[model samples]
Structures are given as structure tokens and as C-alpha cells.
Target: MRMLINVPETVVADGLRGLAAAHPDLTVDVENRVIVRRDAPVAGQVALVSGGGSGHEPLHGGFVGPGMLSAACPGEVFTSPVPDQMARAAAAVDSGAGVLFIVKNYTGDVLNFDMAAELAEDEGVQVAKVLVNDDVAVTDSLYTAGRRGTGATLFVEKIAGAAAAEGQPLERVESIGRQVNENSRSFGVALSACTTPAKGSPTFELPDGELELGIGIHGEPGRERRPMMTSGEIADFAVNAIVEDMPPRNPVLALVNGMGATPLLELYGFNAEVQRALRERGVAVARTLVGNYVTSLDMAGASVTLCQADEELLRLWDAPVKTPALRWGM
Candidate 1:
């Protein structure tokens, strides 16, 4: 594997150090492998915590800041964080209000976060969890029992984090997070596979002129492989899948997320086509984001996430957010 790194084992640690250096507002607990906002445990406010494997940068970590996550725990590439890391981060970031764990619907993530919640509660810290299962690709996968969480994870974090920052109680914040997940749906297509730093090889093989539809972020096999088609045709397929699953209820937030290697220009082109497709189905794109928010290492492709929005959800989404990956109106 031709990766720019001192060694495979220390990639996660080195990346953490780099993140800390880039963002002075963030603090890294190298020993426990948790990243926390410098001004954590904001008094009388519920704290938001989320984490997963390390490869999906600017994800659980980059989203940590005001109006987002208070703490993020990253595990090794495509691996779930241990309970000890989550417990320590929760304890450190928990104010008197409580802590809400935003967990993706993966087997390892679910199990680890559950254990950490128990550990935190045992130590007299109030904790709750909201599982994100917005991927509409499949009902079960190699890593999850139900729908796998994907781009909608970010929507939940931003909306729920805003509620928490507004000093909402733990139950209210958790309910908002859950509602976001319920109202969102996603579908992804992959033109190429990602190479993990440790393995130094593409996670999966895809021949030229072929595309993997409904792929997962961890490089898991998608629903099926089909011959490469026109962008318009592909966009129709992706948008239709999400619409069929949850049928856009008008005033929806549509996110066209590149899977790492796709260029920004191509993503914009895809976004335009996606908007056209959605309109054909009578869905209005109230707000749209086209970029690399959630990624799969260096994979080349994109995913579409649509969340049915109301006045409240749209207001929270537009609220000021200051984070490494996503920042605005701050």
C-alpha cells in the first residue's frame, strides 16, 4: 500500500495529533483516543457525543464543536471504538444536564455504545442513545441488522446538537435526533473501491464500465453491480430509491455527498441532476448540500440523502454551527 504514513499501526494516532494541531479549539485525549471540544461540559446543557471508525474523517471528529458534537471517539480504520474510550469521553463532557450518544446502526457501534452508556450511568452520569439508520439501501448488511446509517448521521448530529446547545433537556434532544433519522433516507453508488491504510489494497474490486449500487461506507458489497450508465439515469435511480423508501414530503433537505475521491465539480453536476430528478417527483429541494461530508476512504462515487423538513427542522439546520468540517452563520 502506497500511503503517506510512518507506519500502519500509528495512522490513527498520527491523524489525531494532526487534527489537534489544525484546530486549536479541539483537544485530543491520545491515551483514551477521544476528541473533545475545549470548552466541554457547558453548564446546564445536554452534551452530544458520537464516534465510529477513524477512516471517515471530518465525520464524528470534524463535526465536534459548537452546535454539533461535544466529544467524538474514533477507533482504528473501519473499527468501532471501545467502551472505555466512550465512557471516559462521556464522563469528561457530561454537564449536570446529561449526555446523548448518537450511535450509527452498526453491530459493533451499537454494542460498544450500549456498554459505554451503562458504564457512564453506573458512575452517576445520565446518558441516552439515538441510533441513526437512514440508509435505505438494504434491510440487513454484514455490519448491521436493519438499515445501515449513512449520510443522515450528519443531519441528526447538526439538528440534535443545535437542540442540545439551546439547553434543551436530554429527552427532548434525543427525540429530535430520532425524528431526524426517521424522516431521512439515503442511497449510494460506487464507481471504485477504497484502499485502507493497513491493508494497502482496494477493499473491493470493480471492473471498468461497472458500478456498485447501494454500497456501504465500510467497503461492504453493495446490493448489486450493474453496467455503468449515464449520470442522469444513475441520479434517477438513486433519488428514486430514497423517494420510494420515504417519499419526499416536500420542503426536503437533499444532500449529494461524494464518497472521498469524486471531485467537487462532478458532485455539483450530480447535485443539479438530483434536484431535477426530485422535482420531477414533486419534491421541493428546500436546502441542498453537495460535497464530501461522509466518505469511504478514497472511494470514487456519491450518495444522496433526503430529509423531509418542517419549519422546526429547517430552522435548527440553519442554526449557527462551528466545526472543522461544517461551519456557518457563526
Candidate 2:
């Protein structure tokens, strides 16, 4: 894997510096590993904070800005950020309206965010938390006690951040964020294993003719492996698992997310199959986003996340948002 990083030890910091240079609106704290909206501590508005491992670019960090995350703490690659990092973010962004921590269900993230909440509360910052365990691919994985968080983290952050931006109180923001999590489900397929900067090689050995179904972001073991399938075949397998687990009750917000290395051309093709599969299952889509929002670094695959949305949720989802990676309705 010929990654452009200078060295394994400096990859996260290097990326943070680049992010800061690119988005002057965000106050990227390279030393502390926290990213904050420059206009944060917005008076009378609840603050939204979320984070996870660093390899998943444009995730917690890139999503920081208006109508999304007020702050984000980035951990080392495939590692959880320390409690101090998250606590720093909470304190920096909290304007007395409280902070809502959108945590993924990974064991390390869960534990560290839990401690960060306590740390932030000790500093007189009220905090609430919502867990995103939307990956229906597996009940338990190497990284999580429950289903691992994946694409739906984007949905939770965007929807809840919109509510928070409108001055919704902590309780209300927490309610909507959790509702997004509960109403969403994700399933991923891996065409190739991801490579870590430190390892300088693929994290897992995925042979040439096989693909992992229900693959996790960190390359954790999934349901099973099978002979490589076509785009349509992959869509049927993934969509079947998702709808079978939780049939959509309303029009859904669909996320056809790439697993880092998959190109936009391939993602759009896969999305067509996904849409066909959903229609076959009688599911309606209110909105569809196709790209690498939540990702596994350099993994050649994609995940489909369906978020069942009510009218209110759709409105929030359509709200204006400005961020490094995703922006619309400015």
C-alpha cells in the first residue's frame, strides 16, 4: 500500500494539518486532536459532537461546521480518541445549552465517550449521548458488543445537528438522534481489505476471488464470505439482509456509501442496483446520497444505509449544512 503519508506516527497529525489548511472555518487543534467550528459555542444552541477512528476521513472531522457537528475529536487510525480529547471538544463547543455526544457502538468509542461525558459534566457542561449501532450485518463484532456503527452515523449526525442548530434543547436533540439510529440499518460488503499506515499492508487477507458480506469498517469479520458477485447480485444480498431485519415503514433516506477506495462511478452503478432491490421490496426512497461518507480506508466496497424518515425527519435532513465533505442548501 503506497499511501502518501510521510510516516505512520505522523499520519493523523499530518491529515489534521491539511484539514485545517483546507477549511479555515474549522479550528482544527492538531495538538489536542479536536476539530471545532470557528463560530462554535453558538449562543442558545445545543452543541453536537461526534468522533471515531481517523482513517475514515470526512467523517467526524470533515462533518464539522454549521448544521452538523459543532466539534469532533479524531482518534489515531482505527483507534478511539482519549476521553480528554472529547471532553475538550465538549467544553469548547458547549454554550450552556448542553452537548450531545453521537457515539458509535465500538467498544473503545463507547467507553471513551462515556468517560468524556463525565469529564465534561464535571466542568459544568451538561451532556447527553446517543449510540449509533445501525449495522444490522452482525450482532457482535471484534470492535463492538452490539452491531457496529457504520453509514448511519452520517444520518444521525446530519439530522440531529439540524435540530440542534434550530435551538432544540438537549433532550429533544438526543431524542431525534436516537430515533435516527433506531430507524436506520446498514449492511456492507468488502471487495478488498483496508490498509493501515502502520502496517503498510492490507489489514486482512482477502483472497482475489472472494468477498466478505456484511463487512465492518475496521475490516472485522462479517457474516460470511462468498465468491465475488456482480453489482446487482451484491445489491440483492445486502438489501435482502437489511429489509428482512427491519422493513421500511416510510419513505427512507438512502445512503449508498463507498468504503474508501470504491470510485464514484462504481458507487453510482451499485446504487442503481440498490434502488432496484429496494423497489422490489416495496421500499420508497425520500432521498439518496451516494459517496464515501463513512468509510474503511482504501477498502473496495460499499454499504447501504436506509433511514426510515417521517416528515419531520425529512425536513431536518433537508436542512442547510456546510462542511468540508458534504454541503448543500447553503
TM-score of each: 0.99, 0.99
Candidate 2 clash total? 0
In Å, residue 240's CA in model 1 sits off its true spot by 0.8
- Evaluated against the true structure, the overall lDDT of model 2 is 0.94
State the local distance difference test value for candidate 1. Answer: 0.92
Candidates in order: C-alpha RMSD to true structure: 0.8, 0.6
| Candidate 1 Cα errors over 4 Å, as ranges | none
Q: Which candidate is the best by TM-score?
A: 2
The C-alpha stretches of model 2 lying farther than 4 A from their native spots are none
Model 2: what TM-score? 0.99
Tens-place lDDT per residue, model 1, 197-280, is 889989989998999999999899898999997778889999989988886677998889999999999999988889889989
What's model 1's lDDT at 29?
87
lDDT (0 to 1) per candidate = 0.92, 0.94
lDDT of 1 at 327: 96
lDDT of 2 by residue, 95-190 (tens): 999999999999999999999999999999999999999998999878889889899999999999999999999999999999999999999999
Give me the displacement of residue 250 in model 2, in angstroms: 1.9
